[model samples]
Target: MSVTLKLATSLDGRIATAAGQSKWITGERSRAAVHQLRAEHDAVLVGAETALADDPELTVRLPGYAGRQPARVVLDSRQRLPTTAKLVQTAREIPTYLVATEAPQARLTDAGVRVLQAPALGEDRPELKAVLEALAREGLRRLFVEGGGQVAASFLRCGLVDAVEWFRAPIVIGGEGRPAIGALAVAGLADAPHFRRTEVRELGDDLWERYERI
Candidate 1:
């Protein structure tokens, strides 16, 4: 399965301010474009931080396309998702999958959500490649990762990212702000992951770029 990592940042590559303020970083056109990208994928995944911070629906919000919403997946190893979250509340409408380890499968299913058990990474995150392979076995052909940084970095560091659709707004957020892609502890430049720029376009006042793994 092909994986696309998508994120919008400021001109200086900040996804959010130093205080974690991230709403409306880009223009309306760019946000709408993201919904269109979500509709094209089989499943859209994000890390627990994004889920906690945004409480996002992660569904295709485009008009008249509600039924085509892809599966919503979250990498929440501890199963900390609250039932009040939009994804959990509307689990019946759109398929919501929680990737966790040894979670209460019965309880989650009772709430109309599916659970995928996997091995943990670091303190409380699932291994990305295993999660991807599990999704592939379930017949998911395309996975889109709409991020909150650390997840994006994990995928990129593991060489699991097939492409990136990065959007840069005209405004600049200083270095104190949170970066678009989180840190990867590469010892040198040669060890760092690289991608070949494939396309660039202006979406409203934002710069939208596409890149493929070199």
Candidate 2:
């Protein structure tokens, strides 16, 4: 299975404001394009932080896309997913899965979401490669990772990201906001995986850049 990492960031490389306010960072065209991408993917993966901060329903909401919805997946290593989250309540048709450690598995299962315990990287963090392999075994062909930053970095560090679709808005959010790609211990540019720019387009004021692993 191939995983595509998708993100919308400001020209200054910020994804959210200092206070985690990330509403309407990209233009309408870019947002619409995201919905189309969601329609193409088998599953959408997000971190627990994004779930708690954004409360996104993770459904395809573009016009004429009424019935199309992908499975919403949450990477909650410690089982920190909130029962009252919109991802749980609004996901009536589409299935929602919570991937966490064994400690929180039962509680999440009791909350009506399917829970899976995978090998953890640390005490409470799920190993990226293990989680991807588990998802692949479950027949998830194409995985779309939409994140707040840390999740994206982890996938890239693990060499699990096969493609990247980045939408760069023309605004700048300075100070203490999250970066386009979170901090990683990458040594140098030579250590970075090679990527070939496959597509570039102007979505209103935002510039969408699509890259494929080379």
Candidate 3:
């Protein structure tokens, strides 16, 4: 499966403030572009922290556009996603999946979520490659990974990310702010994951940058 990681951050690469308030980092145009990106993909995914923190719908919300809403997927190794979340509430209408290392939860399953069990890593997290394969088995070929740092870092660290769609706002948040990506423990320049910039353009006040894995 082809995985594209999306990032909406401040100029200094921060996704949120020091207190973790991340709403409206990018302008309206950038968000609309993100919805368009979601519509182009087969499924949209985010980590458990993102699900619990933001409680996003993960749906394509373009005006007057009537198309298939991309399947919503969450990397919740322990099945932490609440059934009250918007994604769960409207799951019967839109395909919703939860990837976990544990057995499927009945509450979520009854709420119309399909849980895919994956092998666990050393930290008890679902193995990335296994998760992708499971998702592929369900016919999700194009995966859009919208993140909250750890999720982005996981895909990058596993060399699973095929492309990146990054949106950067003009505002600056210093070191105290939350980073857009977590630490990869790159000890040398050669060990770092590299990407070739494919495109760059302005999306309102935010700059949208696209890159392909190198």
What's the CA RMSD of model 3 in angstroms? 0.7
lDDT of 1 by residue, 1-214 (tens): 8999998999898999999998889998889889999989999999888998899998887767745789999998888888889989999988888999776566678899888888887876888888988888777889999987888999988899899998889998899999888889999999999899999999989989999999
Show where candidate 2 strays beyond 4 Å.
none
Candidate 3 global lDDT: 0.94
In Å, residue 133's CA in model 2 sits off its true spot by 1.5
Expressed as tens digits, the lDDT of each residue in 1-214 for candidate 2 is: 8899998999888999887778889989999999999999989999999998888898898877666578888998777777788877754556788888675555456666877678878557888877877787777889999996989988888888899999999998985887868867879999887789999999999999999998
Q: How big is the RMSD of model 2?
A: 1.5
Per-candidate RMSD vs. true structure? 1.3, 1.5, 0.7
| Candidate 3, run of 10 with poorest lDDT | 119-128
TM-score of each: 0.95, 0.94, 0.98
Top-lDDT candidate index = 3
**Best model number under TM-score:** 3
Candidate 1: TM-score? 0.95
List, residue by residue over 25-59, the lDDT tens digit for candidate 3: 99999999999999999999999999999999999
